[model samples]
Target: MHGLLSAYSPLSKVIRKKGIPYLCSPMPPSTRTPYTGSSRKLVLAFDVGTTYSGISYSILDPGQVPEIKGVTRFPAQEKVGGSSKIPTVIYYDKAGKVRAVGAEALRESLRDTIEDEGWVKAEWFKLHMRPKAITSSNPMDKIPPLPAGKSVVDLFGDFIRYLYSCAKLYITESHANGTQLWSSVERTIDFVLTHPNGWEGGQQQQMRKAAIQAGLVPDTIEGHARIRFVTEGEASLHFCIQSGLTTEALKSGGGVMIVDAGGGTIDLSAYGEGPTKGTFEEIASPQCHLQGSVYVTIRARTFLENYLRESKFVEDVEAMTEYFDKSAKLTFDSNPLFIKFGGARDRDPKLRIRGGQLTLSGTEVAAFFEPSVSCIIRAIKMQCMAAKKPISSLFLVGGFSASEYLFSKLKEELAPLGPNVCRPDSHLNKAVADGAVSFYLDHVVAMRVSRFLYGTKCKVNYDRKRADHVLRFAGVFNDVDGIPCLAGSFDVILPKDVQVSETQEFRKHYIQKAFDRIGLEAATSLIYCYRGALEKPLWWNGSSDFSALCTIKADTSKISRCLKPRLTTWGQTYYEMFFDIVLSFGLTELTAQIAWLEDGVEKRSPAKIVYDVDA
Candidate 1:
C-alpha cells in the first residue's frame, strides 16, 4: 500500500512514469435538466427494509411541490399503518406457492392459527443478505435456513415484483382517466430502489437481475423503466435536508453523523457541508452492522411466550405481538408496558396486575432494548472517530428512529460527545422511501468517498533496493533476461476514503504478451479490489481480502492495422496489443470504457463489470 500522501496526491506524474495514461484532467462543468418524459413522468421510489417496506412517487412537474403519495392504493391497505409502508413478512405453502404477503400474511396467520398449521411464514429475511451480519452478540442475530426451498434473492424478487406491479397499476390507471398530468403524455415510468449504504456491487447486481425478472426493467437495448439505486443513509439525509429538518448541522461545515436505524441493519455515515448551501460531502467511510429494532421485538417475544402463555389477553401470540409493536413500542415512559386483561389476579400471583393491567416488568423491557441501544451507540462512536472534525449533529431517521426509548438514550449518550440528536417528527416512518424520491430529483450528493481500494493485478521487477529477496522464493515470478519479474502484485489505482468526483477520470494502458491478441475473438480484463486499507496487498490466491470486483473485456478486431507484434531481446516471442482503459467515476456507480480515442472519434468495445457470489 502507498503512504497516506501517495494515496491522496496527484496520480498523473507518478503513474505516467509507469507507462499508464492516468487521466488527470480537471473535472468538467455540470448541468441539471428537468424530467423530459411526456405530459406526465412517474418515478417510483421503493424502500425494502428488513421488517417493513414503503413506496412513494413524484410527478414530473406537479406545481411548485411534488405530491408524494403513499401506498394506500395497494392490497392489505388498512395494514399500512396510515403510511406507504407494509410489513416485510411473507407466507408460503408447502407447494412452494406464496400464500400471502405483507399484512395479509400476518392476518392469515392469526385467522387460521398458522403457528400450529404447518404453514411457513418468513420474516426478517433481509438480515440474510447483509454481509457478515450473523453474530453471537445478540440472541436474534442468527438467520436460520429457509423453509420455502428458495434462496434469499428468490424471495426478494417476489417482493420487488409485487411492489413494481402496484406502481405500474397506479400510474396506468391515473393516466387512463383524462387527467391533466405534469409532463407531456409521451413519457415512461422510472424505478428507484432504496437499500442500505453498506451494500456493494454484488448485491446491486442481484437486485438488478431480480428487477429485470420482475418485468420492472426491460432487458433491451432501449431499456424501459430506467432503474436507479439510492443508499438509505444518503436518502435519509436528503429527506431531512430537503424538508428543512436539519438546522444545526447545516451551519457552514459542521459535521453531521447520519444513523439510519432500520429494522435489520443500522448504517452510519458522516457528512460535512459542501462549498455552498444545500450541498454536502462524505467525511468518512460508511459503517454498518445488523443491530436493528427487530432484535428488541425478538427479545420481548421470547420472554412473553415463556412467561405469559396462560394470560387471557395474550391468547393469540400474533395479536399480542402486534399490539406491543403498534401501541406500546413508540410510547415513551419509565414505567413497564402493561396490557389490560380481565380481572384474574388470583390465577397467578407472579403475574403482577396493578388495577387489572398485567405489568411487564421494567427489567424485562430494559433487557430487550439494551443490546440494540448499545449497538447504535457503538456505531455512532465509530463514525465520530473516523470524521476529520467533531460531529456537531447526530441525524437519526428511519423506522427504528421513531422509538422514543431509542431516541432518548441516543440523545443522552451523544450530546456529551458533540452534536445534538435530531429525529424528524413527521417523516420518520417513510423517510428512506421519501428521501429516495428527493435523491432521484436533486441527486444531492455531488461527491462520495470510495469505501474499497480499487486496483488491478500486475507484475513488477524485483530490485535489490526495495524488493524483498524472499519474493524470489515465495512470490511467483518470471525470468526476464536474467532478472526476476515478480508477478501476483496488487496495483492500487484508487485508494479508499479518497473523495471521487464525477468529473475526474483514471486511464491505464494494458498490453498482453503472447496470448494471441490478434485471434479476432473475445478479450477479458479482471479488475481486482479489496476493502481494507492495506497499502499494497499482494494478489494471493486464497486471501479473502482480495477478489475480482468486476471483469471487463475489450475488442481488438480493429487493432490498428499498422500495429505489429514485438519480439523481445530475451529470446521470447509475444504479440503486443496496446489500448487504454478509461474509467469514469462521476456517477453513483463506477463505470469504465474500453476504447481507443482516435481523431476525436471514440471506438468502444464490450466492457461490463462481472459479479460473483460470496455473501
Candidate 2:
C-alpha cells in the first residue's frame, strides 16, 4: 500500500531547473531614484532557518535606511534597530491552521494547551530531514503526531507555506505607503531562501516544490515573483565581505574561518588567497552538521528526564512526560532549572522528579553533551586540515554560536592554535540570511562548482567490518599517441576539492591514429569518464556506465583528428554552468544543443563502454 501511494506521488514529476532567472523591473516614477546612472531597486532576502526565519529588503538607494527587525544586534549598536532574532518555530492551532510562526510560534509552544488541540510545534525540524535521518525507516514515528494522516512532509510544507504568507504580508505592510524600496511593484519583492550547504539534491528539489505549492512565487499571485535558493554559509560570508572582513582578509591574504552554529546545524567554511596577486579562494566548504544547539538542548532535556525518572515524584510515565514538557517551557529567566544550569546560583538545586528530588550542578549539565561538543571541535580541525592553510582568525555566527558556554568552549579548544577568534558584530541568527541577501545583490553571477574525475583503475582493499574501501594507484601513462584508448582508459579532470565550471573549459589533448578503414566503427568505442581526481577512476559499478567506445571512418583526408569534448560534472556545477553557457549564447534550455561532433562526422555510439584493464 505504501509503495502504491509512493508511486503516485508528485515527487517524480517535479523537475529540477538548471538555472535561476534574474529579474529586473523598471522603477516607479513617484519615488526619487537614488542613483542618476542606474535605477534604484529593492531585493528581498529571506533567511528560512530551522528554528527561525526572517526577511529583509535592501534598496540600492543611498538615502534609504533599511529597517532591521526581529532579534537584537550584538555589541548593542545605536543604529541597529528592531529585533534581530526570530525563533525558528511554527505552531498549528486547534483547527489544524497555522496559529503562529517564528517568535510568536515559540511563545505559543510554551503553553501546554498548544500541544493538545492539534497545535504542533516544529523544533529542530530541519535536522530530521538530513539524509541519514530521513532514510531511517521510522524517522518521524518518534516525533509527536499531527492532524489525521498527516506526514512530516505535509506538516512541514504547510508550516513553510504559512511562513511565506507571513513574509509576504510583512512586505506588503512595509510597502503600503508606496516607499522607494517598493516603488516598483514589478520586481520589488524578490525573495531568496537560505539553506544549509549539506542539503542533498532531492531535499532542495522538495523545498522548491513546497515553495511553489505554498504560493510563495509570484505566479501564485496575479503577477510574476522570483524565489531563489542561497546557501546559508555562503550568505553569511557575503555579509562578512560586505562588512569589510573580506577586504581585511584580502589585504593580508590571511586565512579565516567562519562558523555558523545554528539551532539545527553548525556550518563552517574557510577562505584564503593564492600567493600571487592575492587570488582569493574558498579553501574549505561548510562542514560540521552535528554542532547545533538542538543537540545541547536535547542533552539537557535528557538529563532532566533521567533525574525525574530516578526521583519517583511523578508515579506515571504520562505524568512525567507532562512534567518534562513543562520543564522545557521554562526560559532562562523564568525557569529555576535553567538558571541553575546556566550557573546563576552557587549551589546545585534539587528538582522534584518521578519519585523524589535530585540535585544537579551546572557543570554536570554542561558535561552531559561533551561528546557532541567534541564532535564539533573535531569537525573544525578536519576542515582546517583540509584547507592546508594557516588559520589567522575565526568568526562565529548563529544562535548557538552566541551561547556563552559554546563560545567559551570553542575558545578554550582553539586557544592552542593562537588565532584571533571573535564573534561578529551582527546577530548570529540573522547573519547568514542577511549576508546571503547582500551576496545575491552584489555578486549576481556568482557560481559554485564541485567536480569528480576518472583515473586508472586497480584492485582496492575492502574491509567488511568497517565498510571501508582503500584505493591503490596502478600505473601512470607517459603518452596517448598509440594508446588504443579503450572504454575504461580515462582520467579525472578535477580531484575532490578542485572547482571547475561550465564556462570554464576542461580539455584533455588526445591524438588518435587511424588503424583501419572502418566507417565510424571503432570511433564509437571512445568513452569519456568524468571524475574529480586523476588518482581514482570514476567508472560506473553497474549497468548505467558513462564509458562509450567510438567508431570512426578511417579516411586519409581526415587522418589526424584531435577531439576536445567538453565534459560536465553532475549536480550543482552542471546546472549552473549549463545555464550560464546557454544564457551567454542567448539560448533557452529547450533550444540548447545536445550533440557534439569531431569535425563534420557524427560520433554516434552507445554511452556505456566496458573495458578490461589487463587488455
Instruction: Give the candidate number with the greatest TM-score.
Output: 1
Total backbone collisions, model 2: 51
Error of 1 at 14 (Å): 52
lDDT of 2 by residue, 178-235 (tens): 4433445434445566777665433544565566666555444332236566667666
lDDT of 1 by residue, 283-324 (tens): 888777777887777777777777777765356445556667
* TM, every model: 0.82, 0.62
Measured by lDDT, the strongest candidate is: 1
TM-score of 2: 0.62
Q: How many angstroms is residue 294 displaced in model 2 relative to the true structure, after the best TM-score fit?
A: 0.4
Error of 1 at 534 (Å): 3.3
Task: For each candidate in the order shown, give its overall lDDT on alpha carbons.
Answer: 0.66, 0.46
Query: lDDT score of model 2?
Result: 0.46
